[model samples]
Target chain A: MIRPGSTLGILGGGQLGRMMAMAAADLGLRTHIYAPERNSPAFDVAAEHTVAAYEDEAALVRFAKAVDVVTYEFENVPAATAAILGAHAPLAPNAHALAVSQDRLMEKTFVAELGIATAPFAAVAGETDLVGALERIGRPAVLKTRRFGYDGKGQVMIRPDTDPAEAFAAIGRAPAILEGFVPFEREVSVVAARTAAGAFAAYDLCANEHRHHILATTRIPAGVSRGTEEAAFEIARSIAEALDYVGVLAVELFLLTGEDGERLVVNEIAPRVHNSGHWTLGGAVTSQFEQHVRAICGWPLGATGRLGRVEMQNLIGDDAHAWEQVLAEPGAHLHLYGKAEARPGRKMGHVTRVYPESD
Target chain B: MIRPGSTLGILGGGQLGRMMAMAAADLGLRTHIYAPERNSPAFDVAAEHTVAAYEDEAALVRFAKAVDVVTYEFENVPAATAAILGAHAPLAPNAHALAVSQDRLMEKTFVAELGIATAPFAAVAGETDLVGALERIGRPAVLKTRRFGYDGKGQVMIRPDTDPAEAFAAIGRAPAILEGFVPFEREVSVVAARTAAGAFAAYDLCANEHRHHILATTRIPAGVSRGTEEAAFEIARSIAEALDYVGVLAVELFLLTGEDGERLVVNEIAPRVHNSGHWTLGGAVTSQFEQHVRAICGWPLGATGRLGRVEMQNLIGDDAHAWEQVLAEPGAHLHLYGKAEARPGRKMGHVTRVYPESD
Candidate 1:
């Protein structure tokens, strides 16, 4: 087992890695960040860092040898990189999780096979496959690349009158999955953690709002029925168990309210700490970042009790310019990512406001 | 004003600096730690660090230029060191605060001048002064070096038959102070913060216990009347205002529960985030470390509301070997400094228990 002073190797250097490093430090663990970027934000807070590319096998070997365990901030870790690091150190969430979550088709099939609800999705290997998928799944389906997609990138919404060929071309003819829209009443997610020993804990459901396909806000006590929230938690637990997961994972679900009453469909799964769980930093007894660290380190999990009713708003671009005003507001917790640029659609930081449930 | 990304230079590499750096990261501020010791605990978490002597003027200037503001984790920051850093960057709590806190004689005089009650003390420069002080203050008093003392170090108790010259020699014949010990019920501390703008917030009073003159544990709800707690806060506020202090300061007090009713006498002042305030990290709405960062950054103060009935225990020396057990216990928050050795009398870490007040 990794002790308090052991070093944890993290693969990635974005805000998620930075936050995770901070959490590890809180538990007396030292973190060494491995990324190709110079002056990566995570590097600032990490005890050590390696400036090398993911494909640099020698660097990866050195990094794995230096830490007790290895974990990554993103799911798109290259297969070769994961294998090289795993050969030298214990890798949390396992390589199987990376393979499944990296591909949309595999992730959907895995979810469907577990007796869980998911959007009707079909594989689209080529233009002919795209046509067949469109005819079978319906005209107004969403075509997404099977691998490496985020923030509405590598996907195109197909309208009833849209050309199938145009949609395929828009995604650069990559292997794709056609998902039939669910007409979700609200989008919710369950951020949870699972230890290697099969121990699991889940935070409260969070309803998310997006702007330009980027997450804008997350609110707890998601205006959903108790049953729906429980259902979301169950789906996340089942997925983690199936994957034999170790570390934090987020499962996004679509809550459809129609003639069938309220029901949930598994939209996607994130193998690492998700953006939607940011509120847990100040709103819960244990943050998802810390929970991930604990699970990966084979330590006992902490309480998931919420401190209060909480709402977290992402400070995209210019939104962070109001940090001074946010600091002035009582009961407001502000977190800045320390990114130098504030280009449009960039996530600069976030602010969380917590209110007593009674109020 | 030091903004979110601005760097805060901290002196000393003990647990206090480690915690202060973590809190600075919590608010998106970067920290640069400067300390003489190699492999200091604070180096693991700070954004930047300089391993150089406190007396190294060139290194101090470089460190100051690299950060937006300067603060210290220990009161014995040499006057010249503070002045060099102050000339390069703004130093919070000021040099005068350091001068007052570094010497027991000056601290007592300052407190008394502010209309605050303190133990009767006389400066002892040598054998004659010690003899005079012993004669005037009576037996069962304490002789302590005026500067560079902590955790019962550099002090000796005098009874009726003790030799004054021996007591003075025992403390290395250093300039010292003789305190007429107050007969008190218990020891308490008021951990508070002040901004340059005069904004102040104080955590609840904490009753403390000592083992072999080293602080062993601290409990909140100090077991004192409401008036006594308020008086402790008032004394702390007066000290801060008089010094024009900015950042967290701790005032150790002797709570006397006598026939005349409960009253408090200032014992010592800590011009930095103190050990007694560690409970506030998980037991209060806002932690003292974060409050100190906010104060020194010219930001608004956060709520000082207590979260529950809290008790904090220092994990000195081999006590930290139970970190695993502590982690297994539910709801017990454990923090360990990244020190390689577990020497006796060394503060390795701490654990805090926050029970619901009703429970």
Candidate 2:
């Protein structure tokens, strides 16, 4: 088991990695951030950093050998990279979890196989497959590249007027999955953690809002029924247990309200801390970042109790320029990622507001 | 004015500096730590670090030039070191605050001059001065070196039978002070902050307990009367205003309960983030460390509302070895300074437990 003084090696160097490094430091652990970017924000707060690409086998081997254990901020860690690191040190959430979550088709298949509800999806390996899948799933489906898709990128919405061949060509003819639109009433997620010893813990369900395919805000008490919330957690626990996951993972679910009652469909699984969980930073007894560190270190999980009614809004791009105003507001907690450029759609920081639960 | 993304130069790379650096980074600021020790705990978290003596003029100038502003974690920053840094960059709390707090005689006189209650004190520069001061202050006093005394070092107890001369020699006959000890009921502190605009905010008064001359635990509500708490805040405000202080300052006070009422006597001032305020890390709406950064950067002070009934316990030496047990305790927040060894009496970590306030 990794002790408090052991070194924790992180794979990515973005805001998530930065927060994780800070959490690890709070537990008296040293951090070594490994990223390909020269000016990765995580490097500023880490004790050590290596600016090397994930594909660089020599650098990856050296990094693995230097730390007691390794974890990544992003789920799309290359299988070869995970293999190399796992050979040298423990790589958690484990390689299987990454492989399962990396591809949309595989992720959906895995969820469906667990007797959980998931959006109807089919593999589209070629143009013929796209047409065949489209005929079966109908129009208004989203054709997404099976791998390396994020933030509304690498995907196209198929409409009645849109040509299947044109849509396939738009995505560079990559292997893809066509998901039938679920028309969800609300987008909610479960951010949870599991230890190697099978100890599982989940935060309260949070409702998420997205703008331009980017997550904008997350609010707790997702306003779902108690049974629906429990169902979501069970889905997450089962998925984690299936993968033998040993870190924080997030499951985004669509809440569909019908004539009967509320229903939930699994959208996707993030094999790492998700932006939707940012509310836990100050709104819960234990933050998701800290929980991740504890689980990966083979330690006991912490309390998942909520502190108050919470809302977390992302400070995107130029929105961060209003930080002075935000700082002036009483009881508003502001967190900014140290990124110099304010390119539109880029995440610059975030603000979390927690109100006392009214009696 | 210094802004987020600006580099904050910090001196004395101890746990206080480490926490301050982490808080600064949360606000999007980078930190550069300068300390004489190569393995200083703060070095692990800062963006840049210089392992050079505080008296190294060239290194001090370089560090000052490399950052937007300068602050120190300890009160005993040498006059020359402050001067050099001030010439190159703005120094928060200013040099006068440091000079006054560094010497016991000056600190007591300053408080007394402000029409505040203080222990009866007399300056003792030599053997004759010590005898004269002892005669005036009476026995059962504390004879302490005027400067560089901390953690019960450079101070001796003067009992009725104890020889004043012998006590002076035991303190190395350094420039000293003789203070008539007060029979106080409890030790309390006001951890507050002041901005350049003269805006000030104070956390709730906290009662502290010490073991072997080191802080052991701090609890909020202080068990003091409302009037006494107000008086402590007034005392702290007067001192901060008098010094033109900008940044966090902790005023240690003694709360005395008498037949008439409760009275407060000023003990000393710490012109930096203090151990007594550690409870605020998770116990208050905004932590003392974050408040210090805001004050120094010419930003508005954050809210200081208490989250609950809070208690912070320091883990000294081998006490930190029980971290696994603490982690297992739900809702307990643990913070460990990245210290390798558990040497006797050294602060290794801390645990904070916050209970919801009863209606």
Candidate 3:
């Protein structure tokens, strides 16, 4: 097991990696951030950094040999890269979890095999398969590329007037999944951590709202029935156990109210820390970042107890300019990602506000 | 005023400076740490670092020119070093605050001049002055060097059988102050912050317990009378106003009970974040580290509200080896400073537990 003062190698250099590095430092662990980007924000806070492309096998081998263990911030870690690192060091949330999470068809098939509820989906490799899948899944379906899709990218909404050929061409004729759309009452997610010994802990269910296909806000104690909340946790537990997952993972779900009251349909899974879990940083007894570090190090899971009624709001585009005003407001915890540019629709920072629970 | 994205220059490279760097990063500010020792812990978290002697004028000038503002983690910052940095960059808590805080005689006299209640003290520069001061202060007094003392260092107690000359010799016959020690029930402190605009916010009074003159545990809502708690805060506010202090400062106090109930006597002042305030990191609305960053940057101070009944325990020496066990504890929030050695009496980390306040 990796002990305190050991080095933790993190593979991706974004805000999530930056947060994980900070959490590792808090636990007395040194961090080495390896990223392709020259100005990755995580590099600023890490103890050491390597600026190299992911495909640099020589650098990757050296990085893996230098650290006690390896972890990544994003799910799209190429299978070849994971294979190379795994040969040199232990990679938590292991290569199996990475492969399953990276492909939409595989992820959905895995969930279905476990008897978990997911949106009806079918693989589409050609124009004929697209029409066949649509006929099987019905109208108002989402045609998404099997790999490298995020924040509504590499996906197209299929309507009654939409042509199947046009939709396939729009996505560059890539291998895709046609998912039958469900009119969800709300979007919610469960961010949980699992230890190698099979211990699992989940934070409270949180309701999420998106704007322009980007997550805008996340509120905990999601306004859902107790049964739905418990079911959400069970789904997360089963997924973690099946994947033999170590470290943090997020499962986004769609809350649907049908004749059976309230039910949930699995939307997708992020094999690393998710933006929706940022609220746990200051709103829970143990933050998701810290929990991830503990799990990946083969340490025990921490308490996922929520502190209060918490709401997290993302600062998108030029919204970060109001940081000064946000700081002036009482009880608002502001966190900025240190990105120099405020490009349109880009995430600059976030603010978390926690209020007392009603008596 | 140093804005978000501006660089913050920090003096000292201990745990306090490391935590301050983390907090500054949370607010989107870059940090440049300068310390005399190479491989200082703070260097791992800061964006930039300088390893040079504090007396190196050329290096100090270069450091000052590279950052927007400067702040120190310890009161022992040399007068010449402070002047050199102050000449180039704006220093928070200013040079005068540093000079007064570094010298015990000046700190006591400054507090007393403001009509505040501090332990009775007199400067003793020589044997003649020591004899006179000892006679006036009576027995059970402490004779300490006027500058550069901490963790019970550089002080000698003058008991009934103690020889005045011997006590003077124990401190190397340096300039000192004789203070009449108060027979108190408990040690308490007020950790607060102030802005350049004169705005102030104070956390709840915390009672402290020490083992071998090193802080062992700190509990908030110090079991003192409400009146005494308010008075302690008043003392801190008055001191901050007098010094025009623009950062987090801690005021240690002795709770004394006589025939007229209870009162407080200021023991000393820490011009930077205090060890006793470590509980704020996980137990308050805003942590002392974050508070210090906000103050020094000329930004608005965050909420100083306590979250619960909190207790913070220091992990000294080999106690840090239990980090894994601590991580397993359901509600314990463990924070380990990235120190390599677990030397006797060294502060390796701390664990904070916060329980809901009883109505």
lDDT, candidates in the order shown = 0.92, 0.95, 0.93
Best by DockQ: 2
Give the alpha carbon lDDT tens digit for every residue of B1-359 in model 3. 77888999999999999999999998888899999998899988888999999999999999999999999899988999999999999998788889888999999999999999888999999999989997898999999999988899999999999999999999999999999989999999999999999999899999999999999999988988889888989999999999999999999999999999998899899999989999999999999999999999989999999989999999999888888788878899899999999999999999999988993
Candidate 3 matches the true fold with a TM-score of 0.99
- After the best TM-score superposition of candidate 3, give how far the Cα of residue B171 lies from its true spot, in angstroms: 0.5
Superposed Cα deviation of residue A226, candidate 2 (Å)? 0.8
Q: What would the TM-score be for candidate 1 when compared with the true structure?
A: 0.99
- The CA lDDT at A3 in model 1 is 93
Residue ranges of candidate 2 with Cα displaced over 4 Å? none
Q: Give lDDT tens digits, candidate 3, residues A1-359.
A: 89988999999988999889999998989999999998788888888999999999999999999999999999999999999999999999899999999999999999999999999999999999999999999999999999999999999999999999999999999999999998999999999999998989999999999999999999988989899999999999999999999999999999999897999999999999999999999999889999999999999888998888999999998999999999999999999988888899998899999988772
Alpha carbon lDDT of residue B182, candidate 2?
Answer: 89
The superposed Cα distance between candidate 1 and the true structure at residue A290, in angstroms, equals 1.3
lDDT per residue for candidate 2 within A1-359, as digits (tens), equals 88988999999999999999999999999999999999899998999999999999999999999999999999989999999999999998899999999999999999999999998889999999999999899989999999999999999999999999999999999999999989999999999999999999999999999999999999998888999999999999999999999999999999999998999899999999989999998889999999999999999999999989999999999999999999999999999889878899999999999998872
Instruction: Tell how far residue B162 is off in model 3, in angstroms.
Output: 1.2
Cα shift from native, residue B187, model 3 (Å):
1.1
Better of 1 and 2 by lDDT: 2
